[model samples]
Target: MAQCASCYFVFCLYCRMVYHGVQPCRLRPGEQRAIRDEYLSATPAAKQAMEKRYGRRTLQLLVDESLTQDWMQENSKKCPHCAISIEKQDGCNKMTCWRCGTYFCWICLVALKASGNPYQHFSDPRSSCFNKLFEGAEELAEDDHEFRRVLVRALPHLSHRSRPRLCLA
Candidate 1:
C-alpha cells in the first residue's frame, strides 16, 4: 500500500483501484519515474522516511528511473520478477512473488543481470552473494545445483560482471 505521501490515499497505482483486503490489480508497468518524482519532491521527513525504509541506493533509483506501465500490475510497486504482484509487506525493500515465491524486485534482478550492482545491501543484510544465480527452476540451472552455487559465490568477484558470468554455459 504505497500512499501518495501527499494525500496518503492507499491506492494501488498498478491496478488503479482502491485497496480491499488486497489490491485488485496486477500490473507490469514500470514505476521508475514516479519513484523519482516522489523522491525529488519529497519533504526532508519523507525523504528520511523513504531512506530509512528503502536504503540509500534504493532511494537514489527511486529518483532515477523514468519509465512506467499502465496495464501491467507490478508497476508502480516493487516487484523484482516483473511477473507477479504480491503486496509489499516489508520495509526491507524486498518483494516476494506469491505466484512463484521468487524474492527481490525485477529491477534489482535486471540491474544485476545488466551489471548494475543492485545487491550491495546483500552484504549489509547478511545475504549471500550466491543469490546471483539462485534463480527459479532447474531450467535456469540446466544441469547441476553444484554449478549454480559455485557461480553465485564467484560472480561477485568477476571482471565480466554481466549475464555471461552468471550464465549456465
Candidate 2:
C-alpha cells in the first residue's frame, strides 16, 4: 500500500488503483484545484485524458467554445466584398482579400476599385477616409510606413495604361 503525497489517497502498488474499503476516495483541495486547472488548459489529447479521469467533457467543450469566440472577436474582421473572415496581424487599413482579390479598407470596410489607385482614397479631400490612414492604429506611423513600402514594391507590376480615370462626378 502507498499514499499519494499531495492528496494522501491510499492506493495499491501493484494495481495502481485507489483503495477504497467501503467509501470512495475523497479528493483533497490541491487535487481538486489541479484537476480544474488541467481541464482548463488541456490540449485535445490531454483533454481526452482529463475527460476519462474527471468526466468534465461538457465543461471543457464550453471552455473551448468560449475561447474560440473571444479569439475571433479580437483578432478577425469580415471582408466587405466576399464576407470572408480575415485575420490581420499588422499593416495599414488597406486589405486585399486572398479569396476574391477585392481591395478594401479594414477600418471602414469600404470596397475600393481594383483598376484605380487605392492611395487616392486616402489623399482625396472629398473622401471620408482622407488623411486618416493611421487613424485609431495601435502601431502608430510605423505600420503606415511599412504599408507604403509594400505598395511601392507592388506598383511595378501594375500597368499604367490600366489605371482608371478619377471621375469628378
Candidate 3:
C-alpha cells in the first residue's frame, strides 16, 4: 500500500492501482505478464530492484513457472483419455498413456484404445495423419549427429558413478 502525499489517494504498490485490501489486484493478468517480461529482460541491477520489490523467491517462482509452461507447450501434449501430459521422445504416432494405459495417436490426439489395430488409423487414406507414422522423425534424425557429437565430447570425463544429470534449464 502507498499513499500519494499531494492527492492523498491510496493504491497498491505492486499494481499501481487503487487499493483493495486482502483481495488480489484487478490488473493481474496483463500486469503480471508485463512484469514477467520486464523482469526477464532486465539487467542484473534492475533484477535486484525487482527482487527487492517482489521478493526473490516470488520472482524466481514466476520465471520458473513461465519457462516450464513454455517448454511443456513446445515439447508435450495431453492425453485425450486421461488428460495427462505425455512427452514423445522418439517413435511412431502410437502412444500409450503412462498413467491410464490409454493408447492414443500423438499426432491426432484421438484415442486408439477402442481400435483393434491402432496403426490402421495412420495407414487409412482419409486420416489426417495418414502416411505420417514417422512424422517429425527426419528432423530428429538430422539433429542426432550434433547430439552424438556433444555426448562424445563429454564421454571422456564421464564415469558411471559420477555422470551429471541432464537438465534442459
Q: How close is candidate 3 to the true structure, as a TM-score?
A: 0.67
Compare candidates 1 and 3 on TM-score and give the better one: 3
So what's the TM-score on candidate 1? Answer: 0.22
Ten contiguous residues with the weakest lDDT in model 1 = 63-72
lDDT of 3: 0.76
Judged by lDDT against the true structure, how good is candidate 1? 0.47
Residue range 28-126, candidate 2, lDDT tens digits: 444554555667687989878656444554444444445445556766788888898887756677889989998888777888878968867778899
Give the runs in model 3 whose Cα sits over 4 Å from its true position.
Answer: 2-11, 16-30, 141-169
What would the per-residue lDDT of candidate 1 be over residues 66-117, giving only the tens digit for each residue? 3212312432344455544444322444444566555663335422322344
Find the candidate with the highest TM-score and give its number: 3
Clashes of each: 13, 0, 0
Best by lDDT: 3
Model 2 ranges off by over 4 Å:
1-55, 136-169
Query: Could you estimate the TM-score for every candidate?
Result: 0.22, 0.46, 0.67
- Tens digits of per-residue lDDT for model 3, 59-150: 66566556556657877999998898998777788889999999889888988745588788899999998998889877766565665576
Candidate 3, number of clashes = 0
